[model samples]
Target: MIDSGESAVSDSILFVTHSPQRSGAESVMLDLAAECHRRGMSVSVACPVGPLSESFPPWAVHVEIPHLGRDHGRRTRAGAAWGMARSMVVAARTLRAHRGTAIVANSAHTLPALRLAGVRSVAWLVHDHLVSRKTRVFIGAGRPLLHHVVAVSPTTASALDGLVDHVAVGRLGVDIPDDAPTGALPTGPLRAGTLSVLTPWKGVDVFLEAVARLDDATAVVAGEAFPGDVGYAAQLRERAGHPDLAGRVTFPGRVRAADALAQWTVHVSASIAPEAGPLTAMEAMAAGVPVVATDHGNPRNLLADRRGVLVPPGDPVALADAMSSIAADPHGTAAMVRRAYAHVAEHHDRRETVPALLDLLLGTTSSSAPAAPADAVAAPSRGGGGSR
Candidate 1:
């Protein structure tokens, strides 16, 4: 826990997020907001009313705004722009009302609105790799408005190299209980699973393909699709029913991370696109599940030095091979799991990250602050339900 004795920096801190969904970035925001509140800072969150709102700390203020950003499949480009414009107006009003509160934009979509509001103490927590040219241009244009830019990983920080100066790496962290379930590999037929929202780029399709190659493994794809990606989710369900996957695959809708990890012998992160820093992978490591992640973004760094297995992105054969190797070599898998657990404890523990982020936000730092690493590529820009 961060000390509550420091002198107040801002009267309050307003956390602005574009989407209402409780995905990776939003999850981080919730944790950060809770910590801020714990430290006796006035905390408020502004976002479209949805599941995320329900998850906010009860004491924190909730300011509703129009859904911002492009919902690629569900809305026309012009419609998204109009929605964003309306959101900006609402956000600007909120900024005026909360005059001295430092602003924390949880997604790039909120940047324009913060810029419109003209708040100088803005911190943009970059969660995804911005691959779209238009998003890069828009964020770059608003760069002057951001007082500090912190990324969830070194790879994510690299993406903002020339676009934003003084970009710092603040890696995502997970809660690791002292008695966290850690031990030898489970004794049973291989059970593989992944915890991610159902979306095209997340590659649930690729995961199903890999599951098809595992003759005896039962697999679970545990997450719900947003409104815009229902068609893609349906396609994944249809793919699961094919003869190859047949009764072996299950669509368990969204389960709690701990519940999902507890049921799986092997956890997979099969995103076709590069992920900035996936919380699910980190959680699995902390929970003692062997991880097989795509070789891109933060997974590459997390799984380096044989802490876990890294398969080529979008390659079902490689994914399948990696899964099989884990099941076949329990001895090796257990060693890797132990190494992974230690690595997460030393680096990605929430006990460390949450305070680091609070210090960064409050403009205070202790000897424990993590040093910024060498920057590397722009990440995929996030929006309402696309390109995350």
Candidate 2:
């Protein structure tokens, strides 16, 4: 429990994010903010003016910090740094205004600003793999300023091994819809789809190629592109018009995950780069939608134990085969769906993860709280059925 003397400040939490886009990390913070508001905590989000700002709960405060990292137009390295510096100025001022409120830096991009603010109660919630040397160096430089560091998955925690210490694994969770079709497979022709920002690294093209191999199955690539990736998005749109995939693939722009998943017979995560913990795949698992993800990063662990299927990254043939197998083996697929639902319910329920995160933000802990164990941060069990 929080100390009585610090209750006043501890009850207020300010979340600082780098992107205005409602991606996985932003969605997590939004959900957390809503939960905090429901619990009568003072919640404020400091981010740039964009789609994310419009989604905050009515009671929560929205502090608009212009040009905060992600949305800044293309610029030189020095220019980007200068923009971040300006954003940090505003961020520091916001921190000073809030005074003792606990702070959650929702992205590594916010770390430098948090360091500049020099607040004591700060938690850096890391969501990326930090594979780039530049990103690793950037995050490592401000690590000492963080009071607590939380990673969304063990793979993510492992990536930060030497860069930061005492890293806690905080797996992303989703609300299992009351109508989630557990143990029930979708009927009719196969409809494989993926829900993520249409970036090259996400391997949306690979998913399209896999869907092309299917004779009559349709596909939905449901997301918009980031500003910097507009060219890639255009390329994807053009590819969708190619001979093989012409009318089979549909780009529905941006969509709610549930809306998209409801239409998908199978959900795919075909990222060329290793994902930390993709919320879309987790949501699919929780909703009893069979997942076929690349056998690397968090997905390898996520889909392990026959809970879902795993395919090699960028392998269209393997991905296509996995989708076809789901339709061919309905009984097996349903069983996998059931196991996935059970796994998500037991391990990734937001009821458990949110409070655990809240405890970190509130500077409180209890025996039952989901704190990291001594040897390593806790992750979902990886042993069970063999990989398909």
Q: CA shift at 382, candidate 1, in angstroms? A: 23
**lDDT leader:** 1
- What is the per-residue lDDT of model 1 for residues 51-168, given as tens digits with 9 covering 90 to 100? 9898776788998876776666435778776666776788777766654677788888777776777666577788887547767755865676666677788778766666665666
Residue by residue across 273-356, what tens digits does model 2's lDDT show? 888878888899887789999988888778878989999899999999999999899889999998888777767778777777
Task: Return the clash pairs for model 1, or none.
Answer: 129-379, 129-380, 130-379, 130-380, 158-376, 159-377, 159-378
lDDT of model 2 at position 61: 90
**What TM-score would each prediction reach against the true structure?**
0.90, 0.89
**Candidate 2 displacement at residue 116 in angstroms:** 1.9
Per-candidate count of clashing residue pairs (backbone under 3 Å): 7, 0
Model 2 CA lDDT for position 357: 69
Clashes of 2: 0
Q: What is the C-alpha RMSD of each candidate to the true structure, in Å?
A: 5.0, 5.6
